[model samples]
Target: MTDRDAFVARLGGVFEHSPWVAERAYDRAAATGLTAGTVHSALCQAFRTALPREKMQVLRAHPDLAGKLAIAGKLTADSTAEQASAGLDRLTPEEHERFTALNDTYTKKFGFPFIIAVKGLTKGQILASFQSRIDNSPEEEFETACAQVEKIARLRLQSMIPGDENA
Candidate 1:
């Protein structure tokens, strides 16, 4: 197998759970050498090509508002989701009562947990985005989520083994 062929097969394993993501990863590796920068750029390029229509398919991948029982630990609730959840552990009884109210309100306004790719964001930043985005129209929110999905898929691709030049 040439580099591209190997890239597709091996990457299939990495994204076995998400086919479109596997395809996107394969396309990227084939066109660019499988180095760090190339992997990152390939994600932005390939995702922009494929993601807007695809993000809705993966929206279910995000965690619940309370960060309870999520797939892959982080997929449903990204890092800040988990952190916010952990904060609940530290809250006093009064704070916990207030948190429950806020959580319910947020969930009612947004169909899913407030999402931000927490890889490069501070907890504060995540909070800001969460509040701002909560008011977005469903269409706008869907687009935003799709964009987040692209960023997330790119982060995922970075950790995958470099695609083989030959299979």
Candidate 2:
């Protein structure tokens, strides 16, 4: 595969189903360089410049935290690993019930699943964030979801690319 193609294939899932973000980032990186930080910035820029509908699609593409897909083992590999990192894979029966209830409430409120970059956070922290953010205005919640998606993309890029461990 060409370098650009390789970049896209490896990073496409960084924004869930939003491979266009990876494609745009790769194009930008060809003009710049393939550093993790550069690609992350380009990906975020692509997301920021997307049309409102596209932005909503990106947000909607993410699976609900500890929701059906995770239970069914159908989450994307990146999502599965990130969720596992936060101990989401090991939820007790009571914890699973709480997550399901919270996810339902949050989705009902915002018309989209609650999104938090689960890396470096405990399940309790994630639950607290969900409870708090569920009360945000739809506009505020949309913006917050997009920001969290960007953080996920940044971490995914940092992991896939070799240099700039500090990025």
Candidate 3:
């Protein structure tokens, strides 16, 4: 594969079903050297400056945490692993029900899934965050979700590219 193609192939899913982030990032990275930091900055810049509609598309692209896609074994590989890391893959029935209800309510309220970067969180922590964020104003929640998406992308990039978290 060409360098750009390979770059996109590896980093594409950093933004949950949004390969375009990687593609656009690569266009920028081609001008600079592709290091973990440069790639991450480019990717986030692409995401951050996206149109509101595109940003919403990225948010909506995410699966509901521990919701139907996971139960049906349909989550992307990255999502599945990240959810499992947070113990979301092993929820008790009651917890599962709670997550399902929260997912529904959050989606209805915010027009997108409740997205937290689940890498270092526990199930209870995630649930607590979900419950609290549900009460946020729509504008507040939208910005919060976008920020979380950026965090998720950073973590994903760090895993593969191995460099500064701030980058």
Candidate 4:
């Protein structure tokens, strides 16, 4: 594969359902160099500068944490693994019910599923964040959600990029 194609293939899904971020980031890589730092910066810049509607689509593309898609085995492999890492896959019935309720409430409030990087958090921590953010204004929530999305993408990139600490 060409270098660009290989780069995209490796990092395309870092931004949830957004492959376009990786594609644009690859285009920017020519000027910035292909190191992990530049790749991440380009990817976030593409996401940051996206039209508001496109940003909404990206946010909406994310599955609700431990919600229907996850229960039905329809989450992307990355999402499934990330959720599992946070103990979301092991929730009790009570915890599941709480997540379901909060997810519904949050989506109603913000028009997008609640999203947080679940890599190192426990289910309790995720639930707490959900509860806390549900009270944010739409504008505040949008910014917070977008920032969380970038954090998720950064964590994903770090896993795939070797010697990332130095980049």
Candidate 5:
């Protein structure tokens, strides 16, 4: 693939379901002559500058931790792998029931699913976070979700891009 094609193909998965962020990053890189050293930051900037509605859409695109998608095998490859790494995919029936309840409550309360970078967290930590964050104000939760999305994107980018030490 061409350099641009390669970038789009790889970074397309950085945002949960938002390829526009990757496309914008590609444009920015071309316009600014961004090097590999700076591309991740550029992609993050693209996400930051996106419209509010688009940002919300990006946030909503994330699957709930151990939600139905995981159970149904419908999660994206990255999401499946992340959840598995966090041991969300191995939850017992009781734990799964708890997660489902929490996910439902969180979505109803905040109008979106609870999102976290599950890369290094255990299922228990994730459950605690979900429980605690459910009480946050909508505005607070919105900001927190956005930050978590950014972290997820950063991790995805680091894995897809070679030698991204700062990712």
Candidate 6:
């Protein structure tokens, strides 16, 4: 079969599980070429990391503070049914108010929600980074955002295997 066809077939397997996850890599694949073989190899080459560099790029591209659809856990109490995991979640009603204000300001300034992979971080940790990054120049934050997204994407890619891969 053609290389693009192989990549498409492979992508079909990966994306079937989570469109969000698949979108990240598939977009990269599409940009490189419609083929499965080249795109997969390109992704591995570009990402260059153990998991794949393209995956990281994909993860970093996500919009944080999603409506109720986040495949990831909630960083805030606003959309979650459970207590917010980040220390920001523990904010008093007043603190919560301020957190929202800051989040709003940050979002307005950046064009996307403040994103951080909350897997290993606590509220305090996320807050510290958030507060610090809030003052970051757009260029700096953009790179930082990309870096974080890359990490998240790598994690997701690792979660998917080649064959038993999701739909």
How many clashes in each candidate?
4, 0, 0, 0, 0, 10
Q: Compare candidates 2 and 6 on lDDT and give the better one.
A: 2
Please provide TM-scores, in order, for all candidate models, with all chains considered together: 0.58, 0.94, 0.94, 0.94, 0.91, 0.51
lDDT of 2 by residue, 69-148 (tens): 99999999999999999999999999999999998888888878889999999999998898888889999999999999
Q: Candidate 5, after superposition: displacement of residue 136 in Å? A: 1.0
lDDT of each: 0.53, 0.88, 0.91, 0.88, 0.85, 0.50
RMSD of each: 6.3, 1.2, 1.4, 1.4, 1.9, 8.7
Q: Which window of 10 residues has the lowest lDDT sum in candidate 2?
A: 158-167
Candidate 1 wrongly placed segments (more than 4 Å): 1-17, 51-53, 70-112, 120-122, 156-167
Look at candidate 1 and tell me the lDDT of residue 145: 73
Reference-based TM-score, model 3: 0.94
User: 20-114, model 6: which lDDT tens digit per residue?
Assistant: 33334555666755443534444444444424344444433343432223334533222242224344335566655555676688878876567
User: Where does candidate 3 have its weakest 10-residue lDDT segment?
Assistant: 158-167
Q: List the residue pairs that clash in candidate 6.
A: 4-35, 4-36, 7-36, 16-167, 17-167, 47-53, 56-150, 60-149, 86-123, 87-123
Using TM-score as the yardstick, the better of models 5 and 6 is 5
Q: Candidate 3 on 43-124: residue-level lDDT in tens?
A: 9899988999999999999999998899999999889999999999999999999999999999999999999999999999
Greater lDDT among 5 and 6 belongs to: 5
Which residue runs of candidate 5 sit more than 4 Å off their true CA positions?
1-3, 30-37
Model 5, 56-157: lDDT tens digits are 999889998898888999999999999999999988999999999999988988888999999999888998898899989999999999999988877876
> lDDT tens digits, residues 10-129, model 1?
554332134555567666665666664565566455555665445444555455433444323443223334444445324455644544555566667655555555565554465566
Q: In candidate 3, residue 80 scores what lDDT?
A: 93
Question: Candidate 4 residues 4-65, lDDT tens each?
Answer: 88888888888888888888878887587777787889999999999998899889999999
